[model samples]
Target: MRKKLASLMAVAAASTLALTACGSDSGAAAGPENGDKKELTVGVFAGWDEGLAVSHLWERILAKKGYDVTLTSADVAPVFSGISTGDFDMAMDVWLPETHATQAEKYGDKIVELGTWTENAKLTVAVNKDADIESLDELAGKADMFGNRIVGIDPGAGLTKAMNDRVIPQYGLEKMDFVTSSTPAMLTELKKATGAGDDILVTLWRPHWAYDAFDIKDLKDPKGTLGDAEHISTYGSLTFKEDFPTLAGWMKDFKIDDEHLFSLENAMFNGADTQEYAPIVDQWISENQEWVDSLTAAKK
Candidate 1:
């Protein structure tokens, strides 16, 4: 998410007032026992399949428990901003201690980090296995091998920022083109290049289906410019715990490993048609009922 400090402060002010109003009526506030305010708005970033999958899974799970869940899509910036301002109840895919460090620091006071569910998250510069280069330090000298361009996703993404701010300069690749586009566009280019056995380099992330869908390898980063491994986390608004204590506790304990996550993502993205993910996720949940049950189990 882009750090819009001014807008964040404005929203923080409004949220403070609303939170104060809620706090004043603590005695009358309803709890999980009474099922009052059984609604939630979850912010999700577009083109983030993991977020989409987890959000939809929660949407379905909460619905089963009689909560009205709304999924709102936007850029990463607004998702964090919305959650900070209480416009959204929570978000499921915050890459922590690194990818979203700026936003987290800017809005840390306004939000609560529920917990990290997916571990070993990473940003990468991936190339077709057939590519000549094996590392980022080698890219500058052989830029033409991959068409003198580095395909990237959303310009606002932390991955893009790292590429432009650190990777390019550190590796002396300032002259090569860095194309900013959507994940789908980058994937399309990747597919085209790999299908024809042509060389291509693209910015990518771990826990993504591309690794399974394509024959690609992450280029080694000798200087560690791309940053260390991260974790995918959940964040809630300041008053979330007070408002939905049970759900908040459940979220804090929620966890998912790469295997299950990849299976879910593959079901959604690698299907014959990518549009019907909710049903696919529903099927996944049905098949994995034990795991889903564990997510909402009573907290000790």
Candidate 2:
């Protein structure tokens, strides 16, 4: 089953890339006749649901305004590289001051940050709600309770790097086994463990649907080893602002608080398939029409 699922995901990724290439070619042909540049390619991080939701939201919203928007999924490294090279016009979910510091530093001059839209973004080691432990400090002594393992997502992820470099050593958890896998795999394990009322510790982040879908709580990071809360920002190619000032301005003023983001993520990813999020986001926009209008209201 896992192999079949992996194959399906791989096919879907290939399809997305094809669509991106086609969209770019078609949009380029149409731009001159349209009297304005109305095409945008957004680079999205694979396995990141927040990026998926926001990318689809923008794709649908911009399409309404006659913009041809394509979402291309890639790993973090390539996404930043694409953005820097101007192959992608924007990236909507960049965790700042820590998670993406390396990428930002490397490509800082090549890209422009439009603005931060979500605050208090966090990375955490979370456990089932009924777990005995409330903090990271308590985990070392009770390692066996969680099978002496910390389930983690992509090894290339900044979260994974932080866990191995700081969280493990700082909390004396080096002895515990840290399992690395894809985000979907980790989530599958989380669901199985939680459904059976078993203790499970998994790397998680805020602004994610898992928090809304599961009964879990973050283990307190008293030592600050996991780092402080960060901000989620929108980044664009260097020419993005010049090419689409109005859209850039709209993105600059776009902000969603935790409540709205959680609800949006829940609506899109909690029970429904991620690929079907565009319609869900369209419905969400209707429900929050005023807020949607506010997001695109012309700057005075």
Candidate 3:
């Protein structure tokens, strides 16, 4: 369940957020008042700061439908792997035709692939403003520009691999070095570099706290190495559907606009009060009853 991803919350916050989905599962263990099903855990990655909110929101929606849920956190790849093994229940932010395409190509039969849950996720290169670099090509012969070290998130993360394999090579950065660190570690480096106004270049992904917190800019990828801005979506083990039919169906049908998701994301990133976010999202769903009714389906 490890994939290094850029912009993931700290290990502690990430861990707590992961367990939130399981909160419903704990309630189920206590016994549901209406004889509803047991609780389950959903592993998460990407979808940045929105992950915890997404997990909690799903948990509430699942509970409303009479099922308990728990959310787990993992690097993007592990989230998919765990679901396939039934170690985790489901995930709703798998970016498709790019991020998890390999998982789909290899494990399509073992797991279930649902439709897009959220769209407009973007992966790219980012550097501190002090670095003054603007494109991957600029790093070709300028090793010192980035300390010759390309800081990356977790080793198993799909985008990191893609950046190392496809993106850098496409931009002719073979001489540069790639270093793997956890999301928090990389951020620590970014914080240090940016705070000191030093040169630092690293991977950047959208829907992240770094973009909101740091004055970093995504370096242009002239070769399309970052891939197109993608549709971030969902996937899970077959058991997720079977064990929590109603909730699973609702999540698959769930879709929130970027403004709504981003607002919650910003709240979580800065550790702001989220009491309002929940109600607003809930009301949006409640008022848009037809959309909720759509998610209120039991199967694909």
Candidate 4:
């Protein structure tokens, strides 16, 4: 009986030590001592359609469970790097089979490639309707009518690289330059041209407010440089799940559909305040609890 009691005590001691090892000062000081105070960081990009996405999905979810989180925007170049290193605990904007494939390759061992947060995301080449350009190939050499420019997002964005190296060449525009601007800058340029009834060609994506707000058409690409439609997803450091299994599992399971993404993107595209975004999205989650739970319920 004494030997068995001693074994039980030893097992208890080991479990306590394991908990201490998993948590830092902040993670240890609060309620549960295992992960009660464990804080997570959710990385975003200006590319994230809704400003509150990280807050709604990461921060609020953690808060609901009595933990804390910090939300920050990941740099276009360093996003993959950050998640690879656990600098940011989780990131949910990897638009893939296209957007982050290179980054995934670049950091294969360092990060965990979670499945899509939402599927059916798209990246498209758009032309103003009035410009009358029916195909991506036609834009070549029409500097005046097509503006001889492909308005792109950040230079570090993988889509920009793909377009500059592949799309431009496939379309045979060897001399034309792709303007590596941002989403806002490209939108401004497009809107300016629209106001003047001028020509503008741009790199466009779905789950964006632009589709709802502007009259633009996606040009056909015979070469398929943009690839087929893909999903925007979540990724994390190699240790993300090991660090927070429950939250990581939730991330793995949680998903948004086209309608959900479109509504949020449309709201932000119309200029919603950033700080108020979390509550708005949380409300959405509450309203769609059944559907959301269908996706987020613990898997067998």
- Model 3 error, position 283 (Å): 16
lDDT of 1 by residue, 1-300 (tens): 221001111222221100111233343233235333666778876657777778877776766665656777666778889999999999888887766788889999999998778887888899999888899988888999988999988776767888889999999998999998667678889888988989999998887877868899999999999888878899999998888877887788888877677777777787447554556777989988998898987657
lDDT score for residue 69 of model 4 = 61
Better of 1 and 2 by TM-score: 2
Cα lDDT tens digits, model 2, 1-300, are 011011213323312521222343554444433333677888877666677777777776676666767788776777788889999888888888877888899999999999889887787889999999999999999999999999987776667878888999999998999998777788899999999999999998787788877899999999987678888889999999888877887789889876677777788876586475667888988987887777777667
Residue 221 local lDDT, model 4: 80
TM-score of each: 0.76, 0.80, 0.63, 0.66
Best by lDDT: 2
How close to the true structure is residue 90 of candidate 3, measured as C-alpha lDDT?
A: 75
Q: Between prediction 3 and prediction 4, which has the larger TM-score?
A: 4
- Where is model 4 poorest over a 10-residue stretch in terms of lDDT? 1-10
The best-first sequence of candidates by TM-score reads 2, 1, 4, 3
- Give lDDT tens digits, candidate 3, residues 1-300: 112244343343234342223344555446444333566677867434556567666665665554555666656667667778988777777656665678777778878865566776777678986565777777876768788888888776666878777987788777788887766678789888888888888876775667656668888878887778777666777865666665555566778775556555555544444433455456545655665565555454
Clashes of each: 2, 0, 8, 0
lDDT of each: 0.76, 0.77, 0.65, 0.62
Measure candidate 1: CA RMSD: 7.3
Give me the candidate number with maximum TM-score.
2
Model 1: how far is 8 from its true place, Å? 21
Return the lDDT, model 2, position 291. 76
Is 1 or 2 the stronger prediction by lDDT?
Answer: 2
Better of 1 and 3 by TM-score: 1
Which one wins by TM-score: 2 or 4? 2
Better of 2 and 3 by TM-score: 2
- Record all residue pairs in model 2 with backbone atoms less than 3 Å apart, i.e. clashing: none
Clashes of 2: 0
> C-alpha displacement of 192 in model 3, angstroms?
2.8
